[model samples]
Target: MTVNGRRVPVLSAEGVTVRIGGRVLLDAVDLDVHAGEVLALVGPNGAGKSTLLGVIAGDTQPDRGRTVLDGTDLRRWRLGDLARRRALLTQANSVAFPFTVREVVAMGRAPWASLPEGDDDEAIIEESLAATDTTHLHSRTFPTLSGGEKARASLSRALAQRAGVLLLDEPTAAVDLRHQEIVLELARTVADGGGAVVVVLHDLELAAAWSDRLVMISDGRIRAAGPPHQVLTAELVEEVYRQPVLVHRHPVTGDLLVTPDRRGSRPTRTPVAPAAGAALDSAFVKEFS
Candidate 1:
């Protein structure tokens, strides 16, 4: 299959299987991640999206099969060499030290230390900060930043790596609405620049809007894989997500929009509590306390 007019696969996962304590996390998963395309993985919690990403990033060993990068097994590549070819942005941005934002981003250049481009670390770091809209946070300590700020800083660090492929797990989960849009747009820009991007996302609307292709996984298997419209049908989503959903094209952008079907459900409202000193009936106190 063609990806952004490119016909070659930059990353390939063949029969990848992961098992933990005899429970399958991913079973016989085969996928081709192509250059110049943004592929989004969507599924319910515990569906193994992050595990698959970990396997592809060479951070986790699979029980069977292998992940290949540029026709070579990822297991055979050196750690430093693999870092140069791909960057992984995990869901958490936990930091124990007091490193400044710039210092954290500068660490991404470690893999290029032996190359001439290593000298451009400062320039790349600045560019990555600006691209992620975190330039103003350069002097702040990473451990002191808020969740959203930390997410932006982490993305800047990953972007500074300047790798050929990006594996982002929930890159936008902690950000606000605008930053969420910014992060996804940046991923698209990376793909447009001939890099492959694989993103794990929970928002079906955003995944449908941003991804060129979608992979829906459930129960440790791929439920569907194809264009967003093909993979995000209302029937399939309702079945896999275990809830009713409405999938329709937007009137303005013509992009697919997903909304939960709540026609038969009662509108949710908070009940007013009794005053602290007010008398309570024995039945009410027994039910609550």
Candidate 2:
């Protein structure tokens, strides 16, 4: 269960905070990502979803608190060493060079350049491409691929990294519906194979459908963190997202299913903040009044 050369507690954040121009982007946030689990970060736009991913990936330093990989601080790990242990697939990846898909995926091995694991690297790269269902485009130019295709290619590259911990920021943003499901399924398979996977997802349905745990964030803090059924309640969803939602058990899987009541016509109730000392505004009071 060790990840990135560290023990089983692959990723941990304690009182983590990030600020940009005096505005708190993430405040006092604590999270843990363990091996063989898919932890989904779900929130509305500007909820610091990507910022949190950057912090975990060692791309952005937090203003306060600590992020640890295994038992060591994230800063202690060299960039190249960190890259070898964790792979981050961001939302804004673009290929300026017209490298073929295979070449692009092979770049993931740069961290292990001096290692004499040639055959293992090649097998992993090929498996990554096939897992992402981009094997057919192996010889295609990266710059010439469609948006969705490019997304899959980037994902394949991350997979090729063969890192024990994987962080994805909006991994399905540019892909079509089918590709979205495919990529999420691949993430699930990776977690099933004993890697730690953290994905920032905007689609609630997809998050509920695939994630083993859910971390809901709002206004620079974690609103709820637990299994999907406990955290993604109807009232909490409406409070954090400002949209009425219905929570039900999926008929087939019996997992929690969150459906937005867009019209807001349902008989809804106000949400009670989970923690003491958390503020409760008049609007919430009026809703339940």
Candidate 3:
């Protein structure tokens, strides 16, 4: 497939599985990501979302199936070539030693070391910072920045790579609510710019809000894969999460929203008003009189 002069189906996996200590972490899972599209992987904790990202990012090889990038097996690509064409932002990224934001963002350029260091690099770095809304933090130390700020900086580093495929694992974790929107907006911008994005998200609402397609995983298998409105139904949520959830369209945008119902497990009880002329009421009335 092709989209806006970029390759559609930029990354794909077939029968991918991961196992450890004879325990299956992921079972025969499959997914496809296209350029100019955002595909979200959503599931509960221990559902293999992050492990799937690792498989797609070439950090881990599937035990049973194949991962293909742009029609070629991912294993065939050279490390440098893969680095130049794809970027992976893992869940935990920390700067042990203090480094300025600019230096950190510059690390994204490591794959293109042969290229001349000139205005282009600076421009790319600046654009990445601007896209992630971290330009103001250029002079700040990475260790001194807040958790949200660090996430934005890491995102900027990935953007600076200018790769055609982007993979993220829990990109919004540890960020404040406001920064969550900011990070997701940047992801949308990346897709709009003709890149393919695959993200693992814990928040179903965020996934429904931003994803062009969704893949729901459970017990390492693909439970559902399709548009959010179609795949994120109440029945599917209950089946995969073992909990009741309500699916409703946003009143304004009409986007699908998934909300877990905590009251599902508790019996409904109606409160009764105190009976008139009861002993408690009579005592209060006598005192007042």
- Candidate lDDT scores, in order, read 0.93, 0.89, 0.88
Name the regions of candidate 3 deviating beyond 4 angstroms: 3-8, 116-119, 264-289
Model 1 spans with C-alpha error above 4 angstroms: 1-6, 267-289
Give candidate 1's whole-model lDDT: 0.93
Residue lDDT tens for model 2, 153-228: 9999998888989999899988999899999998999899999999999988889889999999998899999888
Best candidate (score: TM-score): 1
Clashing pairs in 2: none
Tens-place lDDT digits, model 3, residues 1-289: 6668865588998899899889899998888888898999998899999999999899998889989998999999999889989999988769888899999999998888877643478889998898878899999999999877888899889988889899988989878888899888888988999889999998999999999999999889888999888889999898888889889988998977788787757889876567844867788989999
The digit string of per-residue lDDT tens for model 1 on 112-168 reads 997998999999999999998999999999999999999999999899999999999
Model 1: what TM-score? 0.90
For candidate 1, the per-residue lDDT at 21 reads 96
Stretches of candidate 2 exceeding 4 Å from the true structure: 1-8, 263-289
Top-lDDT candidate index? 1
Which pairs of residues collide in candidate 1? none
As for model 1, its CA RMSD to the true structure in angstroms is 4.4
- Pull out the clashing pairs in model 3: none
